[model samples]
Target: MNFSTELIFALATILLIPIYYYFTKLRRIEKFFENFPNPPTVPILGNARDFRSGPAFFKSIHEYTRKYGNMVHIKIGPIGHVLLASDYKFLEFLLSHNKLLTKSINLKFLEPWIGTGLVTANGGPKWKTHRRLITPAFHFKILEQFVDIFESAGNILIQKLSKESGEKSVDIYPYVTRCTLDVICETAMGTKVDVQNSETSLYFHSVKEMCRIFLARTTSILKRYDSIFRFTKDYEIQKKSVEVLHGYTKSVINSKRKELEETRKEGNYSDVDDLGRKKKKVFLDLILEATVDGQSLSDEEIREEVDTFMFGGHDTTATATSFILYCLGQNKDVQDKVLEEQEQIFGGEKCPKVTYTNLQEMKYLENVIKEGLRLYSPVPLFGRRIDQDVEYDGKIIPNGVGVIVFSHGIHMNPEYYPNPEKFDPSRFDNVEGKQPFAFIPFSAGPRNCIGQKYAMLEIKCLLSKIVRNFELSPAFPRHEMILAPETVLKSLNGVKIGIKSR
Candidate 1:
């Protein structure tokens, strides 16, 4: 009996020993930050134990900023974090001097889906080559052509709203997302999206799944059992959906190629869009002409660039525009002010007919858009990987750690604006020489969003059309949905709002 008991005890000890060793291996990274500005951490998991939301995360960071200064450090589950820009000195130092310090490496998962497109993949020849090639495609001339796309989409949308007139407040989320997707499809690929078709909605489903997978991969607890969970069922499905998206795009390229080939045989292939120019019509057309400092995009590279455009172009704008309209609903005075601005610009009776000239003339409407961006910047935290090791505020932040810049934190900092919480566009008016890098809704530096001009034009055009068709106000409690999440932006809740056509 004694012999048998001893053998069983030995087996138990053997199993427990490996478990202890495995845990230690997992936590090997925690001890190096003994002197840094570490936030209160719990054992075994560190700060993950206490990371709550509903303003708690932002408020905790604000406390850390007060206690440890703006350049403090914290561990987000074995990952080191720098601060959101709370002061000009450190902000300039991190952004300007330490260009190498800021990058987007932890966004590793997105590379497969987004494929080293501007937002996801970082440094090396890949980004530089793609950026150089794709940059000019968004030049002002190309951007201007998209205005009609936005206008026509807006007109169609207002027609739908006119149908919804006098009904109880309706949720605008689906409508807004559909409209943005329609516009992006037209502008980026020149396809007439049959949005009523289920196949067309597959892109949105894949995008939503990818966002979920990103959240899963980033959290530390989920990272454990990584070997077993590496290929999640949902992840596999998402990957398959991406394959579908690629196949669809390949078909587009093949069709275009077939046309060119046939034209070559019979001899007439270079006529342009209806404007009498001698280039092909949409983003794909321009990209075919782009050269990366004299290197043209490869066929596969063109596919990747188009995928990037679809990923970047659609969802974020839909969320932002929906929330902006939601905010307009929530604040009567602000809405009235915007209405007055629209009246001055478009003449009150004809707000739906906003020409490019009138869009430029709507200054106060511009400020309203600016304030909405400030209040709810589409992407809350954009991750960048270090290009090289660099110094910042007397510390050596070694290269390869993720640089997670919280745009939301920077946007809401009270120090930069006198009253950051208040929605005031006049802050922009009075602050001329404030700073070039302060308000980065689309981010800054050479790698900022390529579609800022196109995005602004679309948003302004759509909002002008919306204001004409609907006097928006919340059906739910006013403040209930000032912030809700639909991937990158804080989409509004209830989405429930009244509509009245002019």
Candidate 2:
């Protein structure tokens, strides 16, 4: 009886192959769907349900690619997701129209958190205008000025960590967040909140809470549709928290506006803010610098850009730094290479000024940062809607429907990097012949990260300074902390590591 039962089960497994093929072919014949490069999805809800179900993404995505080809199509309800897990096609599509494809607006969750900033703004005139207006502020020469703020903040962080170095392990999450908060405050709002030492600054805390809520609550349909849940706990927290942020920004803008009046009167017209007070010469001043133009952005517009930069400019870079440290801790050979690179650059010397030029000098360091981004991507996926009917993959992806792309799959494809799981930076070497879209840490094309130069500068400085003194080790297992989905970015188990002076 047992032998007969086993024989029947084996026969059933063989029979199912044709059944599976018939269904897959039938779905294609239906033509409303496509295949994605991952494990066989459960149809309709596809991989979306798996992601929404839990945090086994690294394994899930890997499993899918092994079964399916490099690029897979998935449908969750009416939504279409093109998981370009392979390297070449992903890069081709991304780089070919970096401005259009790299610009994502299909997701429902980002609307609130990003509002109208670079990350979530629509791609046409509004973005162009905002991008144009804000471009001058981040000009390389101008960004060079912000390095002092980053360096100063970096030092404060080092000092605090130095005191706690003997500690078994430290939550570098807050420390890194503080460092970035300090940068944004000085760069965006013109108010230098020293969050480095006091991790609980009001705005800083609010930003964190808001980011947490936004990620937890944003549903894809709502951003595409109008199903935003006003009463939900996630929505409520995000709305109130964003309001707090807006209110603070308004106060700052008001002060700047008043001071702008005084400066105009004085004729010298050096930057100032409301209440006739002096403020840090930051991005706020630069935005207000052009308020005289009749076409200046509205207060809402200004705030949106500010909010966008605050989240976009800082969070991913922070994650990148944290991941870099994690990778360094795990791979001692790579870490040693980094340390050797650092020592050569700053031999027995104090932390450098961290100018734009210094960042270019640290080529190996840049590769390390890129490798970290690939493994534990800050944003594992980016979504977009085709504004007009466009031909893609020999099919017309009709306008207005949602389309999602996966970096988690794209970066891990063996075609782009050999042994995609390993932490290797050499792949980025002689990137000249590399396909246009293969590597996009900050994205590519017109709408890519505006403050990328600023971000790299800060990363280079922090790494240089940190490597000069201490070696890094992992906080704990990377999987222990779940990746909390947020409006802006991702984080892992609070990336704690032991710190010791070299």
Candidate 3:
């Protein structure tokens, strides 16, 4: 062959090797799951066509689990086999497995935005060390200090919503999201962006756009691969979003570091501030002081964790808070009970300083939030990559497969929850012998969300403020929310409700 012909042949051989090996491995997985239940899939395309959109994928997965049983074997284009599971027993096994701690490949989509932060880190020494270093940051003492920030943000949210009250209807998602953004920014990074008041908040808009891009990328098979995705418009959008996100995080990290150094040099790094009150340390302060592998973390490392915190800290809580408002709006009885409890605690003080002790006493409101999370988990699904054979239902689930823990499905299973469609906070009132893994809105296991407690506290504070200040009713009483699957769960139709000053 001529030089050009030989070069083309060599390149083809190089590319074909992986393809040959991939199909060969795929066949083995196919054989292992030959008898496993699954939806009807076309050849080559597998089940890709069924989940061509985010909403379709989310709806279909739930349907497939309900029809084909809890454990459904699904094939997605060239991505190979995934064990979609909603069974509590199977989820408990997979999530608690010591070896199955690695997150699935789907999380790679978030890497551009979050980098290799705790959420995206694989199971290894690095993950362990980072987890160890970061765990203390969420101590009760530190979290107690965040209540002021939460209350402050919530008051701002209530003021903004006051203008919208008495209108036909208003979508509470944007208002709640901006409020949570402000809380997370100040609490997590010790910087106040005031997203709720800022008319042109680049970081807030970028976050929302990035979530949209993530949903778009997941639904389209062509966009799953970097080679094709980079050529698309979503990639361009993602590139811009990442620049804003990363740029903002890096700047915050640098500023925080300088502040830390100044404090230490001034011999004012004691536990108390100039006012003699105990100084509250933000999450970023802990990260800046942390050491890994006998060395202090670099700015990039600090930025990764801060970015992860910003992403996880705000969006999930915002989604949860919005859904809780929707549920309360739909069920006036529950709302009244919550308001009564708020009254007993705050006692006619609208938007009182919700102390940690006060939060502990809002028992009924806590259950309401729990019920909302049960009905509408912010993260509907999360997955893990199995590295070894797993035994379930007297069958061996071979290694090298992805196991998706369908939290939404588990929450809706009538066996675990009677009349699962109904919204009842009382279900959580008595949980003497309920399965622990059955209700995992923050997931279960060693890798469960570290910020879960912080999230709950923030949600409670915001809900307390809103519920105390306004009387809520559903905009579309009988209409259901059109669920859209994104990094955080969102309603495509917007979470709308009617509001007026109480």
Candidate 4:
């Protein structure tokens, strides 16, 4: 045979083997899936066609749920069986299971950017040790120190918003994103990138691009494989983003390491800033000082944790805060209640420096934030790999399958929250009787978000400042954000709102 024919034969052989194995595996698992409802699938392509784009995948999942039951089985070609579940009982079982801690392959897309950080790391000894060491960094006392940073960033946000405060509709997402970026940089690295003041932020832009690329690559089956993805334009963008993101993080790590070495040798290490004021220990500082089994973490390990926090901290909180503001704009009565609660705490002070005690006192505002999180979870979907056969509702979910917890579906389920569409803060007023996994904006159980408390505090602080100083209204009085399920929840049409000085 000629060389060209030989090459074609070799490639076909390589592809055919996997195809054959997947078909065989499908036959073995198809029996379990037979008991579950799923959308109609093509013979070999299965539902793979529906996942060519992120929006399509998101829309199809919802459509399938509406047509099928809450738990919909799907076959996506070689990716294998997936059970999209929003049932709270199944969710509680899946999330709380000690053995079901391995994340699915879908999240493997993030490893290039974050590199097996806590979020993407499987349930193993390293995850357990890292979790143990990092948990202390988010202690309530430590989180209290970041409140000043939150207030400082919130002040910058309010000033920027003041410039845009008028009859004109303003897209608050970018402003909120910058504020959260600034806050994360200062609190996570003890470095100020000043994202809010800069007309453009490279780190901010790179993070956004990375998230966009992840969503795209995740939904496209071909793009999920590095060999194929490397040939695409999205891969080029993703590679550039990683370079920018990792370069910035590595430089910060080197600088902090050098500073620690010098200060410790001099016996003059001080957690005090200029003006003789004590400085708060950042997440980087904690990681730097941490030692596991009598050996400190390497630079790469440190970078992984810092990048994870930086990625986790900014965008998710910013999205939540923006949606909370959007929720407030949509419901004037709820905003009025939030304002009344804020008045009782700050005594009608306009954008006062928020305190931890003050935050604790704003009980009603806390419920508003909780209600906002329920309505628009920043992370709408996350999943775990089924390592072994598990029985739920007397049906077996076979091994080698992935189960994606549809958080948005759970939040919108009327069984969990009556009239789930309404923006009712009172629903959170008494969550004592609520199902544990029913309202998981931060997720639930062991692998839940470690920085959740910190996130909540920061959102509360920022929202309090904005609501205190401004009267918000929907941009069109009937304005509704077009929810787009990306790496983080987004509004395609923009989180537009009208703001006026209160």
Candidate 5:
């Protein structure tokens, strides 16, 4: 045969080998889960077409859960099969294990942005070390110090809102997001990044653009491949965002290190209270001070953790806070109840700040926040890679498969939460009585969000202040607000609310 014919034959043989193996693999998967319910799949693509981005993707998953009964299997091209477990028991089985600690390959896309920080790190020695080293940064006393920052940021937010009170429909999202960004920056890195009031900031824009690109890439099968994605405009934006965000973190890390060195050299490191702890050790300071197994973290490692916190600490909290406000706006009676609770705490006190003690007193407000999180979880989905075969309800999820925990669906499970669609805060009144993994807004098990308490404190501080200072009403009807999950759950239309000064 001629050279051209030989090349064509070689290419055909190469293509046929994978095609044959793909069919063989598909047949085996089908036989393994023959008893289970699966959404229909087509040749090569499988159920890839069913998984779209944002609200539609979530809506489709919910529909599948309703029809397929929680544990549904889906296949996406050459990436392999994903078993979505919306059932609480399955989630418990998946999350409670030490071996299944590695995030799914799907989340590998986030490595470019978050690196192998605590949030995205696989469950291994490195993750254990990072978790152990970083846990002290969120000590109760440390968080208590952060309460002041929360109050300061909350005050700034209230002041900013007061200017627009009763003037027009204000989109509370941007304001709350900026405020949270400020709080995280100050508390996490000891840097004052006032992106909230700035008309334009490279760091702020980069973070926002990165989120948009991240979400787009995560949801699109076509964009999942690095070879294809790198050529796209989204990749360009993502690259710039990483540069800006990482550069910002590096600068802050360097500045903080210099200050620490200066303090040590000046013999001012003696600045400690009776507890023998530094008077002020922000998250970065703690990381710098930390030694895991007698070795301190390098500058790059410090930056990774800082960037992880900078992204996770701010964005998720901001989205949750904004949604909570939107939920309160939709339910005026609930808003009144929250305000009443705030009144009971602050009682005719002008310019009251949310003290740590005050946070404890606002029990009802806490439930309100919990209920909001249940209805609108900031993180709708959690993905995990199945390292070994997982058996659930007599079905075998073979090794190397991807498992997705649909947090939103779990929160909405009728079996767990009666009248799951209702906005009743009383559901959380007896939280202990409910299933352990049913309402995982901050997730469950070992890998649960470490900053959850901090998030709650910050949210309570901000919401208590805002509800006290303004009467919030939804600018649009409750039913009209479309929920979309882009990294965090958000309203497709901005969270617009009418704010009247109280």
Candidate 6:
């Protein structure tokens, strides 16, 4: 062959490889979804167009579920096939079982910010080890100790809002976010970022920017490709955000280590309380003391886990608490009931702080929180990569495809939650009879949120304090509130409410 012909043939062969693979993969996906009910997919792009508006995509999925039933498969582009399962039984099986333990590929977007921490780590021995080592940090006893921190933070929030009390209206999300940030930083890293007051702190800005970038990446089709995304401004912002975040975490870790060393050198390795039990350690301290396979976690590993908790612990809880406040603002009846419940606990006491015992007696308030989470889940969707082929309702879901467990859909399912749109906390009165996976605000099964109990305690503490100090009125009517899905469910226009001192 001529030299030019030879070169042309080599290039043709190289191009044909991907083309052939693409067709074969497309055919396989078609065959796989042939038996399943799926929304109409266009050639090559599949359902990519459906997600052009990233935040609106969840609403689209909800509409699709309503039209097409619960277990609907979707394809995004040539390679991606997603199964969005909102069926209660399907979720119970998927989340509770060990076979499908790995997180979905979509979580890869968070690795740049959180790394392979518990939130994004894949299933296997490494994840198992991490889970075991970190679980102790959230033990009931440890969480009980955190109540003081929650109270302190809640007090700060109340004091901050006191200035705005009886003002026309305020967007409460930023205040709640700052308060949660303070609580999580103090609890997780044993350091205080004081983000509630220091609004422009590098740590606070880094976390906010990181979450914004993470959500933006998850919603953008073009941004999913690292080669293209890295050159963009979002990617650069993400990198800088990570730098600030890691720098902060590293400093906290070093400071704690130094403190530990000083204690050890002074022959005061442990301290005991009056009850004779060793003093509880913070999350970072426990992780530092942990040994996986007989070796301690490296600084990067510890930082990843700390960052994961900081992100998970604060953001989701803040979103949930904000929405809970919004729900109360809109539903005066519900708000009245919650305040009545709080009054019953405090009994006209002046400036009563939320004790651990106080949190337990607030059953009515707890139910309200649950109902609010049901309507607006903090983490709306749980995505998993199916590790093995699984059969559900006698249909086979092929292995290697992604499964998105839509918590919002499940929460809104009329069958599970009657009058789903109404803010009725009574549904939780007999929650024991509900389906196992029906109310998964913190998710379900083995990978369920470890900090869930802590989150609940924190929310109750803050909400109790807020309701006691202010009469919350909706800035906009119930129907006017618009929600957008980001790292967590957020108000597109901010959660605005008018607070009058009680």
Best by TM-score: 3
Each candidate: what lDDT? 0.68, 0.68, 0.86, 0.87, 0.84, 0.85
Cα lDDT tens digits, model 5, 192-308, are 888767868788899888778777778776798999999999988888899988888899889888988998898775658669965877899889988988988999889889888
TM-score of every model versus the real structure: 0.84, 0.82, 0.94, 0.92, 0.92, 0.93
What's model 4's TM-score? 0.92
Cα miss at 487, model 4 (Å)? 0.6
| Candidate 4 local lDDT, residue 382 | 83
Off by over 4 Å in 1: 1-36, 52-69, 78-85, 97-102, 196-200, 223-226, 260-280, 349-353, 477-479, 482-486, 491-494
Q: On a 0 to 100 scale, what is the lDDT of residue 453 in model 2? A: 78
Cα lDDT for residue 80, model 4?
Answer: 71
Which candidate, 5 or 6, would have the higher lDDT against the true structure? Answer: 6
Candidate that scores best on lDDT:
4
> Which residue runs does candidate 6 get wrong by more than 4 Å?
1-16, 19-26, 41-44, 273-280, 476-479
Candidate 4 runs further than 4 Å off:
1-24, 48-56, 269-276, 391-396
- Per-residue lDDT of 166-202 in model 3, one digit per residue for the tens? 9468899999999989999999888889888898999
For candidate 2, the clash count comes to 14
Tens digits of per-residue lDDT for model 2 on 23-125? 7543343353443334455757766665652355545555666676655555455334443344466445644564454345443355565576666766777
With a 3 Å backbone cut-off (N, CA, C), the pairs that clash in candidate 1 are 103-384, 103-385, 104-384, 104-385, 105-385
Compared with the true structure, the alpha-carbon lDDT of candidate 6 equals 0.85
Instruction: Give the lDDT of residue 144 in candidate 4.
Output: 88
- How are the candidates ranked when ordered by TM-score, highest leading? 3, 6, 4, 5, 1, 2
Instruction: For candidate 1, write residues 85-153 as lDDT tens digits.
Output: 445564455555524523654466666676766776555578877877777888877776777788888
Candidate 6: deviation at residue 433, Å?
Answer: 6.1
Q: For candidate 2, which ten residues in a row score worst on lDDT?
A: 28-37
